[model samples]
Target: MPETYRVAIMGATGAVGTELLDLLAERNFPVEELVLLASPRSVGRELTFKGQSIKVQDINQIDFSDIDLVLASAGGSVSKEWAPKAAAAGAIVVDNSSAFRMDPTVPLIVPEVNPEAVLEHKGIIANPNCTTILMGVALWPLHQYQPIERVVVSTYQSASGAGARAMEEVKQQAQAILRDEKPVTEAFPYPLAFNLFPHNSPLDDRGYCQEEMKMVNETRKIFGVSDLRLSATCVRVPVLRAHSEAINIEFQQPLAVAKALELLHAAPGIKVVEDWDANYFPMPMEASGQDDVLVGRVRTDLSHKCGLELWLSGDQIRKGAALNAVQIAELLVKKQLLKSKTVA
Candidate 1:
């Protein structure tokens, strides 16, 4: 019989949290017991998992000693407070937040790009930012063919990246606009309906927002290239889910468009969608709810012989967040790294 383990889904009622629950069942993870954890106010709220109704336990009161794996989709502050505790208690925590991503001791991972990194984790594994995960899944294969000299990317992020409330805000705002009424704001400072804006994350002195910097630094960490050159502009569009990115990559050698397409098609976690006749390429609508990153529009940069350009879209919540975290847990189990072990 397959060895089943106890699994905990932190922040069990949020957008990514809900997806985690569904994925655990859909993927048929070897789960012996499923625990739903949330804030105090959410305590007693029941969530369904694999046809079983599990009540949300207060994070503060739960004992992590018996859990074998924890899929944490809670925000950073929540992760910062509890991830270590869970780890110390012997649960391998796969955190889907920015909390410990850059920590030298933690392995920041995308299973498709760096599954081996899971073996090096002390206790917690950090899932990359949504945009970074999408880009890495699509570009890592190409980078392996030839070292990437530099990368320039601009992201069209969707409202779902902000959270469930933000997604609702976009819908309500759009409806208000259609009715010729004023749109109210809470999740964002500005209206996200019918208008797009630069990512609202805190801005640094370099004028790049925190979201943009995550792409630069996190990509370097995941690729094991400390000196990888990358610049990104993250913008939030009014879409409900999924994210789109335009990528320009400079390589040491000139890689042909046909070769790029061939490589991408052969790569796992990527689906190449292109049709010159229709001028159609990967779009957010098609990429939503997909596990694979939809990639297409392979072309040579007109200016630089060694530069190539491409476009990709992926479901920010699925592939970008929940699915990636689940994949990491799957990797750990497959490698037998989820044995009886505790963080030192």
Candidate 2:
């Protein structure tokens, strides 16, 4: 008999939450039952899955005891409040927030880079930040070939990372600008249309914003390297979805461009798209809605013999958040790591 699991999406009506629902159906996960959960204002909203309409339920009312897997994409606050309850109620959580990511106890996962780490999870797996996940997936293969000593990255992030409403706000801002009207500043601290700014997350004493630090700290945790030298600058671009990054890496051993291309081409979850003749490379438009991270512009850094530069773009809402969480759930099932007490 085929084994099936009961699954619940903690923020089913939100951006990442909606993507999670689509991925579960698109991947044909062995779901015997599906439940949609959201905040009180979103309750009773209808979302379709596998040809059936499932009404969004308030998370407070759902019984986690029967759910084998919880794909949580709600904000950090909600996850902090509910994730422990879900885990204690016998549900394995794959959380898509910053809430438990830096928690040393939870294994921060990017399945392609660190599948073995999943085996150590007690009841939860934390997905890396979108930028970190994309960079990890694209760079880990090369790192395996030659250890990376340091990384410097700059991100061109889309409004979708802020949420679906933020994306919509960008559109409205653009529309209002066309009429020469003042752009609204509700979704973001400043107008995002026809303008860009440094990531607005809170800053640390060292001046790194929370988003930038997430890449630094989360990368070290996922790669299991406590001292991996990395720094990042995150910027919010006007694009509605997907994100692009320019990465410079210093390897412990000398690596050639051809060798780097060979490693990236053979890596999982990465697509190489370089057209030197036309100077074409990965773009946010091309990467939007794609599962694989698009990587290109591989070249040797001019300043250092052991350093290399590359560009990559990926769907932030997909592989970065929802799809990664779904993949972790699949990994748990494939490895039989879901606690026996939770598996029916």
Q: Cα lDDT of all candidates, in order? A: 0.94, 0.93
| Candidate 2 lDDT score at position 55 | 96
Q: Judge candidate 2 against the unseen true structure and give its global Cα lDDT, from 0 to 1.
A: 0.93
What lDDT score goes with residue 66 in model 2? 83
* Residues 102-199 of candidate 2: C-alpha lDDT, one tens digit per residue: 99999999999999989888777898899999999998999999999999999999999999999999999999999999998898999999999999
**Model 1 steric clash pairs:** none
lDDT of 1 by residue, 130-194 (tens): 99999999999999998899999999999999999999999999999999999999999999999
Candidate 2 off by > 4 Å: 339-343
Clashes of each: 0, 0
